[model samples]
Target: MRAKIVFASMTGNDEDMAEILEEDLLDAGLDVDTSDVSFTDASDYLDSDLCVLVTYTYGEGAMTDELVDFYEQLKQLDLSGKYFAVMGSGDKTYKEHYCENVFDFEKAFLACGAKELIAPLTVENAPTDEDIDRIDQAAEELANKLNG
Candidate 1:
């Protein structure tokens, strides 16, 4: 199976999470590719059997400008039969908006007809050991769902 991870990270935390998740998925025997949101084309999403979105919520729950174009394009695509998962890092101090970008991506993917393989995962600021473990478990579950 093939998976694609697209991410937008400010301060690198979300990028790190994406890399870790990629490793977990790879170890589970799926081929995986990743791209920065600024560099991703809408076709990138269509090319994968599964897609993982990793992003950070900027102030007030906004996604970074780097992800704006790709995010818009994702909304226009028909993602039926694609599986998706969302994970992200954010500052919980924001409370109301913490990790909102992750949820935003999940909602958009669902609207475009993507099926979710796992619930969204959120890390506070950077991923902790527990967060890493959770991500790994999610990846394994995703692999099982696709490869079973």
Candidate 2:
């Protein structure tokens, strides 16, 4: 199966998480492509069987400038039959807005007729071994979905 991973990061935490997930997915023997949200074309998402978003919440649940454009592009597409997952990094100190970008991406995908393959995954500030384990589990689940 084919997959695409798109990410937006501040301070590299979100990108790191994406890399780990990419490796896990690659090892599962699926063809995977990854890009930063700023640089990806909307068609890249539509062409893939699985699309995953990895991003960090900007101030007060806002997406970054790049992701704002990416999200708007996503709103214009009809992604029927696509499968998606969301993972991200955020600080828990922002009680009301922590990892809100992940949910925003999930909502965008659903609005465009994409199905979610897994619950959103969020890490506080940075990932720990526990967080990596969770990411691995998510990758395994995605692999299962692709294989099935």
Candidate 3:
């Protein structure tokens, strides 16, 4: 299956999460590609069979600029039937609003007509191996759903 993974990161945490998921998905037999939000176009991502979004929230529930732009563009575009899964990186210490970036992406993807095969996974700052494993499971499910 072909898939695109897009991410918006701060403190290098989300980027690390994206890299791990990308590698795991490839090892699981998928045609996967990764790019940062600034270098990717959400409308273009709609062309992929499956799209995974990884981002982190910061500053009292503020979504990153890249994510905001992508979400705005994606919500306005006609995805029609793109399949999507979301993973968010955040610090639980941030209080009140954690993982807003992942939630934001999920809402936008649905608004643009993408279907979700699983709920968003929000990884706390410096996620554990179990967090990575969960992401692996999510990717596997995504591949199975698309390939089967």
Candidate 4:
């Protein structure tokens, strides 16, 4: 199996989550490709068995500028048989908007016909040990679905 992780990080929190998930997926024996959202094309995941997005919510629930294009493009793609997951970092103080970007991406992927492999993950600022364990568990679930 193969996985592609595309992420956007302003404070590096989202990037860290992406890295952690990547390591977990690699350990599960899947080939993984990861890149910053700005440099990656949403269509690039077409060849992969799994698609993942990790991003940080920007200013009160807005998508980060660098991720806007990718998100839009992703919504327009056809990922009918693909499996996807989304995760992100946000400040919980934002209350209603916390991790909103992650949810937005999840919706976009669903609109493109991709099946969700797991629930979207949202972390406050940075991930704690428990959060990391959740991320690891997500990877394990994805691997199981792909290899089942």
Candidate 5:
């Protein structure tokens, strides 16, 4: 099976999460394509068995620049029945809706009829072992459900 791991980040926390997930996915013997959602074409999500989104929120209750463009530009793509998972990386100290990025991706994918296999997960600073465990487990489950 194939997977796409896409990310948008400012301080690189989100990117790190994407990379970790990519590594885990790769170790699992899946062919995975990964890129920054900003510079990469959003249309790539269409080809993926699973589109894994890792992004961070900036300012207050708003999307990052890459994420903003994704929703505005790529929202028109036909993603019906596609599977997606979102992971948000943010500082809890900010106090302004830490999971907003994950929620935005979740809502956007659902609006486009994409299937969400699991509710989103969030990590602060770096992902803890527990966070990685959750993501890796979910990813494996997604792979099984989609591939079999």
Candidate 6:
């Protein structure tokens, strides 16, 4: 299976989560490509079996500026039959807006016909060991769903 991970990080927390997922997915024997959302096109995931987005919710429940165009482009694609997942880091102090970008990405993927492979993950800030474990579990589940 092939997987693509596109992420945007401000304080590097989301980037760390992306790397953890990438490593775990690689260990699961899938071919994976990971990139910063600013450096790649959203359509690049069209050729992959799994598409993952890791991002940070900027001030007051907003998508990072870097992700806006990618998000728009993603919404225009036909991702039917592809599997997708969204994960991110956010400040819990934001209350209802915490990790809002993650859910936005999830909705965009769903609207574009991608199937959700797992529940969206939102970290309070920097990911802790427990958060890493959850990400690992998600990777394992994703691998099984694709490779089974």
Best by lDDT: 6
What's each prediction's TM-score? 0.96, 0.97, 0.93, 0.97, 0.90, 0.98
Every candidate's lDDT: 0.89, 0.91, 0.82, 0.92, 0.80, 0.94
Question: What's model 2's TM-score?
Answer: 0.97
Instruction: Count residue pairs with overlapping backbones in model 3.
Output: 0
Ranking by lDDT: 6, 4, 2, 1, 3, 5
Model 6 Cα displacement at 32 (Å)? 0.4
Candidate 4 global TM-score: 0.97
lDDT winner between candidates 2 and 4: 4
Candidate 5: where is the Cα deviation over 4 Å? none
lDDT by residue for model 6 (1-148), tens: 9999998988999999999999999999999999999999999999899999999998798665678899999999999999999999888888999999999999999999999999999899999999999999999999998998
- How many clashes in each candidate? 0, 0, 0, 0, 0, 0
Q: Tens digits of per-residue lDDT for model 3 on 46-129?
A: 568788888888867876677678878888877667788999787777776788768877888888888898889888987688
Compose the digit string of candidate 1's lDDT tens values, residues 57-88.
98789766667778889899999999999999
In candidate 4, which residue ranges exceed 4 Å CA deviation?
Answer: none
**Model 2 regions more than 4 Å off:** none
> Please, what are the lDDT tens digits per residue for candidate 5 over residues 1-148?
7889888878888887888888878887789999988777778888887877888877566875667888776578778867888887877877877767778888888888888877787888677888888778876776677767
Candidate 2 colliding pairs: none
Listed per candidate, the RMSD to the true structure in angstroms reads: 0.9, 0.8, 1.3, 0.8, 1.6, 0.7
Cα lDDT for residue 11, candidate 1: 91
Q: How close to the true structure is residue 102 of candidate 1, measured as C-alpha lDDT?
A: 89
lDDT of 4 at 123: 90
